[model samples]
Target chain A: MSGPIDFYFDFASPYGYFAAGAIDALGARYQRTVNWHAIVLDANFQSLERIRIPSSVMRSDYIRRDVERVASFMKLPYKAPSSLGLHTELAARLFYWFNDRDPQQSRAFAQAVFKAYFVEDRNIAQLEVLQQLCCPLQMTPDDVASVAGDSATRARLKAEIDMAEARGVFGSPFFIVEGERFWGNDRLPLLERWLDAGTY
Target chain B: MSGPIDFYFDFASPYGYFAAGAIDALGARYQRTVNWHAIVLDANFQSLERIRIPSSVMRSDYIRRDVERVASFMKLPYKAPSSLGLHTELAARLFYWFNDRDPQQSRAFAQAVFKAYFVEDRNIAQLEVLQQLCCPLQMTPDDVASVAGDSATRARLKAEIDMAEARGVFGSPFFIVEGERFWGNDRLPLLERWLDAGTY
Candidate 1:
């Protein structure tokens, strides 16, 4: 039996963006299908009382260092997000909506949003920017807006966050292969090794 | 001025115990003092929602494999902790008390504790085991208990935890050399290199 790899992601997280692209490559290389579970990280943080405190100067610095470390390792161009934080809930839900229709399109949408914020330093919170992001994916701005406004989609997003919390998921770019959750993107190589072993 | 290495630690963390011993050796090797800060990991989990779950069945299966990988890489024993979970708050505070009295004694105590829990499979939570552990050091059981119970020590412990939370300490065995926090015991050599560079 081939064990499936579940990719949990949030577009706002640079790590998530990195994992989305890399996991896709890994899936192709290993002949494994990645089941994408797009999740809103903000809601998860709020539910866990994991607030982003403004006074946490060291906290921000650590994130900067981590981003640099990961980017350097991955050979990806990364600058700390210019906006304080991306409103990931809307973006994740939109990805989920698109994934339901076309998974490849969802991947493109995730990448575009990441590039919009990380590469271009654009404010993703602005609706116009999000609408503009959808154009590249051939997803109508109205359709994207419509999906973003769906109460059911929002509820599904919440369910995704709840499921992650229930499963003891603590961080983004979490990979669950055969019910085992690897919390960090750095563990992807380890996850791949496990897949190759064919033990589980 | 040689700035102190802010040692971020969680009392209940075994890796913290490992780092504590190695940090002392590193300090002696480099002629520096490590400013140890006791941080409550439970508080970090609450704030960050990063809870430690056991490795997956497959991941667990891969433990022996990875242990060998890490052991060969670091040239250190990579045994898993005996007890599934340990309460480190009291042990941490006791460590502070011991350190305040004598650094040598504290280092011995830390090493003993690590060996007991990680190597010998002893339950560190049991007072009887702790008393036996303390006996070799000639630490009066009553005095040790009193120190563990001191309100001032408890308050100081909480304050230190608060400081760690503010400083963005996410995991155990975190070392800060010249204001840089390096997470994980594996990062100690890298920390030593940075210290040698003497760039603050």
Candidate 2:
């Protein structure tokens, strides 16, 4: 229970964005480190042969109303992006790229990407938006292009996806500590309790 | 805000069963009445043409693990039934049947049915099991058979489904307070806050 927490999420997930704000703070309070693993939701399900998440948020009205109210309830800044099917793999690739060099900066970059797409209504699928996001963090466009063009980054993401598959991670905002699995943003209270008591 | 809370849920949903224990207490604390509408998840999605919840809990390992932890987290008694796709419509019919005469008894019967399946590992789909559940409530076998034999109860369930469709309900453990929709058992906290503050 005192062990480090592992977070597995897809960048396209809104709940993942919402959870990004609180996860680090929770880890800090508990004095445990959080390990962020970026995986694609599409890849996770395609492997399981379970239901495929719709490529567009426009396909599900329930998700639209649910996330909007959730943002309001969670007091997080949120605006619906025109398209949800953006460059999740690219964002994740860049995350691993930054993550290898400086994990702290990678966390910052992840937050920026979430904010850009969710709050600012920017299309992160495009390279320019990601480059603009990277600029503030001292990452040059060449750095992004290098990662994008590299087949090695593609292999890195595949390894992450393979790791997720090994762990049976089926949803976003998944948490694992001491072999206990908790899924979805709503389960955080339970995860927090486990962290508090060292067992539930 | 002081208006009655509408709860839409499917009996097959373990979270819905977990939620049943607390919703009444929440409503009573706020001096609000809870109107429980027993919905079948299968029908809800068939109408919407969305993803169908796997008929059997055995079909999905993830849901199985998720609900077991949730039951522990919520401190509710739960035993996985041998089969899940049984008698949801029958249970809904019986609830409405009693609701028309004695709402209190109907609530009690609803609780008993939930316990029979989730806590006792009994099948509510069996007439004998439901009848055994009814005995303590002073409802006789004739009363149960009469409803089962009647086409009226089938129509009654259809009406409930139609109403759910009109309300845009698509999941179990759905709550609507004055047109604000909250989905999932995890969302009860947010729903309670809305009740507490009158608006969030």
Candidate 3:
């Protein structure tokens, strides 16, 4: 009788990239559906009144090292991005566009994007880069572009971000299970426990 | 052959309060000594150029929920402090003063301070409040004041904070295991794993 687990994230967040790899399998282990939502983080950062992390020297250094360490611990392949904090708005919009029709395809799209950024060190903010990523998912670059730029598709992505903020999701790789909010990739263990034991 | 785990924290941090409950036991499980250090966070926050939590409306609400949930998860008793961000400079300074002399008593003193702030909702910033805390440790209030007021003690505490900053500790409840840094209470599990089987 439980609802699907909501896994909200920004594609640009490396932690989000890390969470993406594990969340689905975790959901399957608990017999729950993992609903992936790629939402923009700019609005959340604005509300928190903080600058993007890669813009800061100290935080970025910590994050760079932490990501590598976390990747090693999680046993996921990770390479530092050539550029950090690349704008993820287009990637998010395309995810909603694909998700509206096919949830499975959208997840594949997300994985490809994550690999492109974290593993390949590609600049995901560029349209050509994103378009090249679509080929592996069997998505046409032209079709991907058209849908990502559609007004309705943009609106859908915006609404998701708005809902995330209203739900008090102020960080990436956020999860909500039956109204309980757990933020950050670090909280995944707690999320798994909640899904398994229905919270303490 | 294992080194003492350096557990750095700030008294005013809620996460620090939560971590204090379990760090020593975790160290014991691995047969490692937990060396507690109450370092100032103001310098780190200034370097990061960010306002402290509990000062922000949205963040404080999330933290209140997070601490309670984390406490429930850890099976520890917790109550939200009536006030937030009470200055802990005096508490930290006194901790170093006592720690230099007797490591055991300083740890007990720290536990008392954590309980006073988190469980009792006592404002720990007050000198008299700290004096009252020392009584339980069998130290007279005057004696507590004398050591905390010593310029040499204050200088020692400042030096610790300076060293922590240089080592790239930018958050409370920070841990360094075998020359590797892990920040936040959320990283405790990773720290435990590193201690048990060595790092990946």
Total backbone clashes of candidate 1, pairs 3 or more residues apart or in separate chains: 1
Model 2 native-contact share = 0.28
Q: Individual DockQ of the candidates? A: 0.11, 0.46, 0.40
lDDT of 1 at A76: 74
**Model 1 Cα shift for residue A46 (angstroms):** 9.8
User: What TM-score do all the candidates reach, one by one?
Assistant: 0.67, 0.94, 0.92
For every candidate in turn, the CA RMSD to the true structure comes to 6.6, 2.0, 2.6
TM-score of chain A of 1: 0.86
Docking class of 3: acceptable
lDDT of 1 by residue, A1-200 (tens): 46778888766677786787688788777788888887766564443423222323323656667566556556677777656456777787787788888988887887888888777888877767888988878878898788788999998888878887676555678787776666557667557766777542
lDDT of each: 0.68, 0.81, 0.82
Off by over 4 Å in 3: A43-59, B43-59
Fraction of the reference Cα-Cα interface contacts (below 8 Å) that each candidate reproduces: 0.03, 0.28, 0.25
Pairs with backbone N, CA or C atoms under 3 Å apart (clashes), candidate 1: B12-B88
Clashing residue pairs, backbone N/CA/C < 3 A, model 3:
none
CAPRI accuracy category, model 2:
acceptable
